[model samples]
Target: MQKVDAVPKTNKSYTVLISLIVALGGFLLGFDSAVISGAVKGITVYFEMTDSMLGFAVGCVIFGAMAGNLLAGPLADLFGRKKILIIVAAFFTISATWSAMATGYTEFIIARIIGGIGIGGAILIAPIYIAEIAPPKLRGSLVSFNQLNIVIGISVAYFSNYFLVNLEGESWRWMLGVEAIPAAIYFLSLWVVPKSPRWLILKLNNVTSAQKTLSKIGGAEYAEVTISEIQRGIAKKEEKGKISDLFKNKYATIMIIALGIAFFQQITGINAIFYYAPTIFEQAGGSTDSSFLQAIVVGLTNLVFTLVAIWLIDKLGRKPLLLIGTSFMTIALLMAAMAFNNATYNFNDDTLNKISDTEIKIALADLNGSSFDSQAALFSEIEPKLNQEQFLDFKRNQITNFIQINATLVLMAILLYVASFAISLGPVMWALISEIFPSRIKGIAISVVGFFNSLVSFSVTQVFPWELSNLGPTMTFAIYALLSFCAILFVYKFVIETKGRTLEEVEELLTRK
Candidate 1:
């Protein structure tokens, strides 16, 4: 390897600026994800959705993301990273506008899926571009800029939802539409950032242009060394990696670690918590206003703890963080399950009075003063009294008023869970994925695992509404808690420490028999 310290210090500030601008895509991805939580109730009412339809509406974004994950790398390879990013920004802008304006369920879903495509592309490409341009010392931090932006976007979406929740007549439209402002900004901003220098060298064999872009990022000497390395890496791979290559015997360990981390990351219910935070709080007997407010707290807690994770990840190492995070995640989920388990529902006069719907109020009048130990039991008692629509309305809209439980404990448990996730699986999983794959198989391996990750995310989000409706919150949380425990054991046995090692060193360590 060649050293390039002879020139003046590299233009680190310029490099940081480029990374931040590229990372703005992450902001849109996060905003698109969480903003829908506030819209869930409104859309359900407007669309007249059943449990399954509601789940599809909310989880459809990940469906589109699956397609994006498969296509983005190939598309970027054909054109350039910058162009695909511009296209992603365009998708976000269109999705936000179309979704807000959509009057039909099909139209609204189509719009949301468009944004999901942007999410799939942005989440994968932004970090790749940042890593390609950043100096080795700054690479990890610069790539992390995307993850940090994601949490910031999540917090901002929560605040945006709260402020718009009180708007009259379809405030959900405002919540979903406001994302266009940032999307447009990101679209225009892409024009300023250069194409990936490595792409220029590898695809076009335009060393001069690659060096020019790299020179602006660092300096002439830095560009020279970087170009040589990129070319050498490309030369060593006589054939590009294919999807079939990932199944080979030597890559078995890599596949196991990558796919396992990807599976556990979503199956443990982080997205379920984030995408449905307001709804979860509402289930614990909170008012709509309080639920939205508490969701903002969840987002803020996630943001703070994510910062903590970044600071401690290299210091604590990857496997330890996964072990610690998954363990605490299991405990926090159990705490939530226990809290919901201890809850009892009583429909007193005061609770009945809180029901605004006249039919629902009258229907539940007979059940006043009757108490039930579990949601399933209470729902069963009420199931025969009302018709299908009435029962659905009672369950979705009116049940919150009749619950008597420790709201504080549920809130605390959720906050702890979010904190634990942010510090461990949230960032650590992506970091480890990037480290474990050999450079030859890195692109395809990431795509395969990323697609699987989206598939799991879609399943969790899709089933959550149905779970809440059928199995009740306690059982739903218990299932997640069980999965979290499994995640801990998987990490302890299979995951290796990647801290302070070069990518080559980490690859060699993991690949060795």
Candidate 2:
């Protein structure tokens, strides 16, 4: 007879099989954020609306976010994580279906808010839940899956909007509604994924059920060790957090870091471009078709660069990536701001209506492989007319600007912003959220952090259109770029490295500090 080893199964396959459902929440979050880009155009047309209305319509999701995040922490802690997630899935399904069927702007806005709430929680919870459950060796990559799902969702939404926008009638509504499919999938996926053992033991005081779930994920031997670690955490946890507890200098710092990151992300003004890039391009000198095409490009670049961050986070480590990315993005934003500044003009009359002639010349140049020369010639000719003209033609410069710097360069800059975000703010902030909090109060802190993050999202999304309207693109972008630099500094000075550490170890380090 031979003794056999009883080490827990660490098969990538098993973990992945269970994780498939958990990641669905990420998918839903991404889909909901982007589906609005498509709806904004049709909704504006359908409702005979304008920029302010469209802006409100698009940003309304943050309202949902505010509510979702407010409730997500207490609910998760009170009922356990999986139960809250199941509730989130239901919200997604309902919101998506209703959004597609919305008759008026009010209906649509309400649905998006409802849907946004679900996404806000899922976005925050999915990664944390995944991180807490995975083996230490696989945590980063496994958690990165949450982000990967989000990108996929954004990508799909872009593609969906593209396909749906051309449909004969109310295509935008269809685009909004179609997301219900994934929402349903997410709800269904939750059926199989086990509850977080740590949540179960710590909050529910159910060590046995937690052990069984842990054993299923990691086998008996690993479950025993996992249970032991979770209990240690349970012992370390003080009275669950009070709002007053956050006032303590130590916890206050944690809350500030979280809120600071959230604020940094918003003030970067990425949402201005995201929610209104088409309009900005239109202002810059692009046609509806070109603007839509450019919007798709932005989404693709966002997805690809996010993938880049996911690949590199573990390899490059967090600090260097954040600092380097912030620098690159800031430069691009400045370049864009300058480009927009150069294109600024004050045409006074129906000149925009008359720019057909100029577009012809630009088109001829394009047809002849001399596009740049002709385009430059057109802009040089038009700039003075637009700058000087008062009432003869108010629109010529706007239309001409589209052909000049609108589509390509502006998109390049915005993509740079997204790239920076994907690498620095996008993934890293979430990583920090999962990392920096004390484990005892991690859920409450995370929820509060997410609440403030959503607040930032709400503020950015709500104010960007107004700011862009008043401040103009160049100034708006420059300001955002500057804010991003400040964010880079914030992290470099105050934040600590959490990569490659166990949750337990990270908590110990934080407390020791």
Candidate 3:
């Protein structure tokens, strides 16, 4: 396996610039995926929905993502990566604007699904584009730029939602609409970046065009060497790529790693935390404003640690990071479970004394010292006792003051969970997915695993409200903790190290029985 040394200084800036342009797609992906965290309560209230309906509306984007991931590979293979990425940006813009103006739940779900399509496409294509074009010495860090932009986007969405959380009843609309600005920038930025040199060489069979694009990526010497390597790789896999090729014995190990990474990444409930951060905090006895503020903290922690992952990915290797991150994730999730498990809610003089707000005290005046097993139980028992407005007022303040669990402990646990995910699985998973397959089948292989990824994400996000309603926070997080435990073992025993290896070398090494 050859290492990518520093390219000629002249092409360094050019390589980084193009990589950043493509990475904007990741920004929109993060913003669209997470902006909903702050909007879910508003959407549920505005639409008068059941928990199931709320979950469906929240998870609808995954359906679109499923469709987009299913098609992105073939489409990028046929039409070129850059063109499809441009179209994905357009979809994001349309989804954002339409979602903001949506009049009903149905319309909002449709808009979210549209945005999901853009997210799915961008998630697959951006990393592929970066991996194909980046110098190997910097490939891990450069490709990680997509993940970095994603965390930045998530952080910005959290900030935006928090800033707009107090905008009366219209705050959710503002959160959804702000995505359009970045989407348009991503669409326009495509004009400046060159096409994937490998895509041009193999798919287009236009070496002259490929060489020109590669030249812009590095220098003429870098272009020649890269072209030779790509040509040799293509020659070895002369038989054309098909969906079936991925199932062959030689490709089995890579397939397992790809699909396993995709599954563990989502099934461990990362999206559950990201998509429902505010709701989780609110359920754990916090005000809506406080929930949104805590979500901002989660976003910032994600941003900072993702940068740490980028700094360490090439230096430390992929398998070690996955093992380390998942281990910490297990510990963090157990901490969250314990925090929720020990929490007790009792409406009493002691609880009353904790309340400093007048409206809350007045609303709960007759019910001091009454104990309920969960917030859901508490709400159900009290709903018929007061008017709707009074019920809501009491509930908000009750949540703010009732829980015996330490709020800071819950917040720290969640922050730890996000940090664990950011530095290991978050960026490393995508880097491995992009690097493991043969060039010819890379698109289709990633598509299959990516589709599976979206499906799991959809299922988890869709069922979360129900999980909270039925299992309670302690059990919901307990299940996630168990899954994280499994993921750590899976990484330790089966996942291989792909840190410094080239794509061709990884493919060759993994293909051996």
Candidate 1 — what's its lDDT? Answer: 0.87
lDDT of 3 by residue, 84-122 (tens): 999999999999999999999888889999999998999
Clashes of each: 0, 12, 3
Higher-TM-score candidate among 1 and 3?
A: 1
Q: After superposing candidate 3 on the true structure, give the runs of residues whose Cα lies further than 4 Å from its correct spot.
A: 1-4, 349-367, 372-401
lDDT for each residue of candidate 1 in 109-206, tens digit (9 for 90 to 100): 99999999999899878877886776655665667778778888999999999999999999999999999999999999999998889778877889
Q: Report how far residue 279 has shifted in candidate 2, in Å.
A: 2.7
What TM-score would each prediction reach against the true structure?
A: 0.95, 0.86, 0.93
* Cα RMSDs, all models: 2.1, 6.1, 3.1
Residue 34 accuracy (lDDT) in model 3: 94
* Number of the predicted model whose TM-score against the real structure is largest: 1
**lDDT per prediction?**
0.87, 0.72, 0.87
Alpha-carbon error at 139 in model 2, in Å?
A: 1.7
Query: In angstroms, how far off is 162's CA in candidate 3?
Result: 0.9
Worst 10 residues of 1 by lDDT: 1-10
